[model samples]
Target: MAMTSLPSLPLLPLLLFAIAANVALGATIVKTLPGFEGELPFTLETGYVSVDDSELFYYFIESQSNPKEDPIMLWYSGGPGCSAFNGLIFEIGPLAFNITDYEGGVPSLQYYPYSWSKSTSILFVDAPVGTGFSYSKTQAGWYTSDTKSAWQTYQFLRKWLIEHPQYLKLQLFIGVDSYSGISGSIVVQNIVEGNEAGVVPRLNLKGYILGCPRIDATINDNSKLIFSHRIGLVSDDIYEAAKKYCNGSYDDVTTSEPKCYEAIKVYDRLIKDINKYDTLEPKCTWASPNQEEDMSRRALEETSSDDFILSPPKIPDMWCHNFNYAMSYWWANDRSVQEALGVRLGIVDNWERCNKSLQYTLDVSSVLDYHKNLSKMGLQVLVYNGDHDLTIPCTGTQKWVKALNLTIVNDWRPWIVDGQIAGYTIKYSESGYRLTYASVLGAGHSPQEYKRRVCYEMFNRFIHYYPI
Candidate 1:
C-alpha cells in the first residue's frame, strides 16, 4: 500500500501564524485521515429485550465499509452510566453530529477529521439500562447498576454475533477510560472461558485493547495519592497530615482527611474564581496576562475559604486539562438525542429499559482470578496504559500488574517507535500473550484522541502483528 503524503505548505508568515494559533489553541490534527468523504452511513437494527417487565433499548452500528476484513470492535464508555454511542459519535467513528444546534432543523454530520474506520468495524452499544438512550421504565432499578449490565452486554454480544454471521469472524471487544478497564475485562473473560469449556461457541476471538483502562477499582482509588504526590498539588508534609486523618484506610480517605479537604477546598475556590473560567468545558488556556490574573484570583479565593469542611475535596485536577473528561459530562447530559442514529433519544431509551432484565454471571472472585482462569482457557490478555495520564496514572497500573505476579517473559523497557517515547512494553510469554505499557507523549486519559498516530501504531502492532 502506498503511503499518502501530507499536503505541502509554503513557508509564509500567515501560514506560520496559523500553525502557531493551532498550537496555542491545543488543537490536534490527525495526519492519516481516511479518504471516504461525507457521513459514513449505517443501518441501525433496533430491538428490545424484556428485563423484569421493562423494555430496554439496544442497537448496533453496521459499518458501511467495503471488504469488511476489519473486525467489529464493541466500544463502551466509562461511567457505567455513560453511553457507548457517545464514544462512537465523539471519539473514533467516521461521523459526528453537532448536538449544540438541536432545536434548529439543520442536521449535519461532522466528518471525523481523523478516523479509525479504515482498519476496523465499530459497534457502539448502549449497555445496562439508564445509560444514554437505554432506560428501564417498569423495572425502575433493574439496569441502574454495573455488574448486572455486564452480563446483559455479554449475552447481547453473543446473540448479535449469531444474528450477524458476516461479522462473526471479525468481532473484537474494545473499550477505554473506565469501562475499558472494568466491564471490558468481563466481556473478554466470558468469551475465553466459555470457549474453553465448549459451552459457548468461540467467535473470531481477537485480543482486546484498553486505552487508559480503569481495571482495578482499588488501584484507581490509590492513584489519587500517587497523582497528588507526582504533581505539586499537595506537599509531602500535607499528604502526611492527610494520611494521619485517613487512619491508614485507603477507602474514603477523601472524607476523613481535613488537610486534604482543605487542599481541595482551596483548589476549587481558586478554580471557580479563575478569570475566563467556563464551568462546562474548562480549558487550561488564556492569555498570559489574564492567566496570571486568574492565578492570583484563585490564590485569593483559596485563602478566603474556611478550613473546617468535612473532608477535602478532590477536584479533577491534572497537568493536562484536555476535553476528554469534560466531553463525558456533556454527552451524558444530552438525554434527548441519539448522535449515531440521528433520531430522538426517546426511541433508544425504551430498548435499554427492556434489556435491564439481564444479569451478570461473573463476580469479584472471577474478576480477581481473571488472569489464571482466562489463561487456562487459551485466551490472551493485553493490559496497556499511557504513562503521562495523571487521571489513571501509570504508576498505579504498574503496581497492580506487579501484584498480579504473572510470570514475566519479557522485561520492562521503553517501547519506542520512530525514535519517540511511544511507551514502555512488557510481556509474559508463559501466559500466551504480551502486556504492553505504552507511554503516549502529551497524552492525558484518552491517548487515542491526543496521540492518534502513536496510538494507531500501537494498535497495529498488537492487533495486526501479535506475538512479536
Candidate 2:
C-alpha cells in the first residue's frame, strides 16, 4: 500500500482544467437566456449606440431557473404608438383578464399557473421609441410613421443585442400583431440579411410568428369586397352602394365623408344582429362614464346631421366609446414613449377623432416598397386574419395577401386543430422560403383575447417545432 502511493500528479493542472470546464458549463447555462440582463420589473436601460444616434430603452425579466434552459421570445404590440406592456398584461403573460366582476370599478387579474414562460423567456419591447415605455428626448422624437422609423428601430434593437452579447447564440423569434406585422417583418429582414452579410452585429433569428397581421394596405381595401362577397353583398346594387357610399374610390377616406359615413351606416345595420344569439358582451363595451360621454357626443353629431339623418336609437346602445382620455393620459405620462416616437399632439383634433393624416401614415401602402425589398431578401412572410374581427376582418386581410402575389406553397384550406373551426390557412413559397396565412376562429382584431390557447399553440408549433 505504501509503495502504491509513491507518485503524486501535479495539482495545478487539475485545478486549471476544472476551472475551464466550470467556465464553459456556466456559459452554456447563461446562453439559454438571450437578453436577460438582470432582475424583473427593471427600469429602462437607455443608451446611444448606432450611427443614426438612435436610442434604446430596455428592461429585463428574470428567468425562472436557477439556471434556466428556456429560449427568449421578443414580444411587440401594434398601434405604431401603442405599448408592448398592454400585450404582456392582456395576452400570454402570467396575468390575464379576470372579468368576474363586470360591474366593478376596475378589472381584476388572474394568474396563469401555466404559461409560455414554462419553456420560454419573454421580452416585451416598446419599440420605435414612441411605443410603450421606450422614448427619446430629441426633437424628431419617437414618432415612427414611416420606413425610416423602422430603420431606426432596427438600429436600436441591433445595438441592444450587441450590448448584451449573451444573446448572440440564443434563438430569436419576432412576435407581434396588427401593425407590428410590418414592423416585425422589417426588423427580421434586417436581422437575417445583416447576419448573412456580416454587415451589422448579428442575431441568431429562427423565424417569426404573427397574429392577425395587417400586411397589405391595398388588400385590406379589397377586403371590403371579400366580405361583401362572403356575406351575400355581391349583388350589383351592393357593389354600387359600396363605391358610391363607402368612398371606395377616395384616395384618402379616413376623414368623414358622406359616402363613407353612409356606407358604414349600412354595414353596421347589416352586421348589428349577426351575432345577437351569441350572448357575448359587445367587444367594445365601455364603462358608465364613457357610455354617457359617447351618448352626448352622438346626440350632438346626430343633431348636426340634417342632410343625412342618423336614425333614432332602436335597442339600448352599447357604449363603445373611444379611449381618448386613456390614450392621451398614457402619452402625456410616458414622455419617453412620446419623445422617442414623435407622437404628435394637436396634429389631430382629438385622440378619438379619426385622423386622415394618421391613417395615411399607417397606410400599408407606405411600406409596400419595403415589403417588396424584404420578399427579395429570402424572408418568409406570414399574414394571419380573424374571420369575426370587425376591426380588421378576414376578408380585408385576404384582399391584402392576394396583392402580394407570392407563390402559394400550401393551398387555401381550413386549418382544423381541434374539432372546431380554427380558421383557414394559405401557404406561399418563394425563393426557397415559405409564407403562411392563418385565420383564427371567433376572434376580433386581437385574436389572442378570443383564442389564446389555440393561438399560442399555433405560434409554438410554427416557431419552436413543438405541438402545443
Q: Which one wins on TM-score?
A: 1
lDDT of 2 by residue, 1-468 (tens): 000111123553454355445434322111111112233231222222332533443333433432144456667766554556455555566544443332322333445533455455666665655343343455345344445555566665554554454554666667777766776766676666666665534466766667666566555545655465565635566567767766465224554676675655565566565431111334342211110122211210111112221111222354221222233223333434333333332321222211111211442353455556655555444466666664455776666556666887678787666676687777876775566778876666567656667676666565554322
> Candidate 2 at 456: error in angstroms?
1.0
The C-alpha stretches of model 2 lying farther than 4 A from their native spots are 1-71, 101-108, 232-236, 240-364, 376-381, 466-468
For candidate 1, write residues 47-115 as lDDT tens digits: 443444334445455554542676677677654444565456555665555433333233334555445
lDDT of each: 0.49, 0.49
User: Lowest summed lDDT over 10 consecutive residues: which window, candidate 2?
Assistant: 296-305
Model 2, C-alpha of 400: deviation from truth (Å): 3.6
